[model samples]
Target: MDVGQQPAAWHELAATFATIAAALFGLFFVAMALHLDAISTNVTVRARARVSLQSLALSVVQSLLILVPRQPPLWLGIELITTEIVYVMLGAGLRVRAGITALIAAMPIAAGISLIAGHGPGLLLQVPAIIIGVVLGCWQAWNTILPAELQTRRTVTKARR
Candidate 1:
């Protein structure tokens, strides 16, 4: 199959992805900052926040790699896999959080392997992967911003009234 032939379309997609990923990171950062105390003191919240940022940062890196001019499919694939490796490694001590990250990284990892093999959905797979990453990141960010205890407090307060 022909690779790198559809540069124009892929570049546009990648550029858009990079833009969205960066913006999401910014929002997540603010959320993390707002709950800094909660996150620092709570291991779970801290892990979630770390995963959120890790996911967003990986998405940005993936998008940038995808945007590289005339890059070979195998090279892109290797890069994606390598990035995921680092992501997994970074989440190593997080236990279940790392599992969650591995699941989320699965799509892009598969897409990368597929690209390397010159078959399958190729770059298109990353579209959903990117969307998924964004959602997961945002979810974790929200959790950081409002941990369960805070949410429970709000609920109890409301119930009292």
Candidate 2:
């Protein structure tokens, strides 16, 4: 498709999110590497990290779907739905946090449906989706990567209030 054929907003949003996803993915990998031993030894940490990783993966995939050059929105829509379905399968055994990630992924599903139907906000929905994913990913990293004594100190401080 010609560059002029596609709306500027779609291309810009997709391009920006692609950048954001790449940067966040790198940060997540570093955070995980630092906490790898803790995450591996503790089942609970492993489980939480899995969901966090899944969330970051979803953000990356969603950006890629939109950034595919000149692809029709309908095709992108179909791809988003398919990706979310497979993502659900991948995170199947995970519990509440996984459920939250599933819900976060629902935005892309909705965005896809809207794009397919030729109405609604279309790719703009991805703004909130990626934002939430990055924020949650960072939150998880902070919670999962900090030293145990720091966490305990924070908890104790909070309890004193």
Candidate 3:
């Protein structure tokens, strides 16, 4: 594919990514709703849940941005970088796994920098970023919720003793 020409492949990729991101966001929302009380009552859990939601929202927005016709590569790069920075900042207060969060945060910024520099096919870089973001989002949500659930069960067992 020529550097200057838009790849025909992007359309299908963008559509697929957008759909998946949207679905993941919906699933996360439902999960949050189910655990609303636990999340709201605990400050730590609330922060983690907020970060998780932000991560998913970032992925969904990035996927939709890819679908925009005639979007400037520079603008997309800026958007990606900005969102990553926001994610990192949001996670700053949470007791998340630092290594995983760092890796997840790095992927999108690296991809965005490549896109800004015009290193190679934009989609090639962008697609991985989206995938990583979605995976990270889901992981954060599960990481936040599972331990709380376990703790609740343990407390109930102790009370029964």
Candidate 4:
């Protein structure tokens, strides 16, 4: 696949990414709802949840940009970079782990920039990067919820004792 050509295959890949990101977002929302009490009681857990949501949101936007009909590469690059900056800033205001994850999450933006500049493997690199970001986001969200649930259970057990 030529980097200059926007193939149907590439669009299909982007659409698949969008679907996955949306599904992950829905799952995260359900998990948060189920653990709302634990999440609300802890600032760190809340920040982690926020970071996870932001990452998933970024994945959806990036995938949509790729799927957009006749979208210019320059616009995609600009939007992706801008989104990464915003995400990193938001993470910086949270815990150190979130800030680190935010930096890792921006890897896709760099790949997107390379694609726009026509230097990279185009859709091949972009697709993987987007998927990785979504996975990382889901992992972060799980990390947040699981620990909180365990802590809550422990607290209940102790109180009963």
- The backbone clash count of each candidate, in order, is 0, 0, 0, 0
Tens-place lDDT per residue, model 3, 70-97, is 7777777777788779767865424567
Question: Model 1, range 26-129, lDDT digits (tens) per residue?
Answer: 98787667656667888878877787888788889988998988788888888888887787788632634555656767877887888888787777776777
Candidate 4, 1-161: lDDT as tens digits: 36533534568778888898999999999989988889988887888888788878878888887777777666666676777678677663254465556555556567556656866655555666677678778877888889888978998999999
Estimate the TM-score of every prediction: 0.78, 0.76, 0.74, 0.78
Residue 96's C-alpha lDDT in candidate 1? 42
> Where's the lowest-lDDT run of ten residues in candidate 4?
1-10
The runs of at least 3 residues in candidate 3 whose Cα sits more than 4 Å from the true structure, single-residue gaps closed, are: 1-8, 92-95, 147-161
Task: Compare candidates 1 and 3 on lDDT and give the better one.
Answer: 1
Candidate closest to the true structure, highest lDDT: 1
RMSD of each: 4.3, 5.9, 3.5, 3.1
Model 3: residue 13 alpha-carbon error in angstroms: 2.1
Candidate numbers sorted by lDDT from highest down: 1, 4, 3, 2
TM-score of 1: 0.78
Comparing 1 with 2 on TM-score, the higher-scoring candidate is 1
lDDT of 4 at 98: 54
Across 1-161, the per-residue lDDT of candidate 2 in tens digits comes to: 42322334466676776677678668867877765665677776776677667766777777777777768777877887787777678863253365666667788788778777767777667568778876776676566667533555676799999
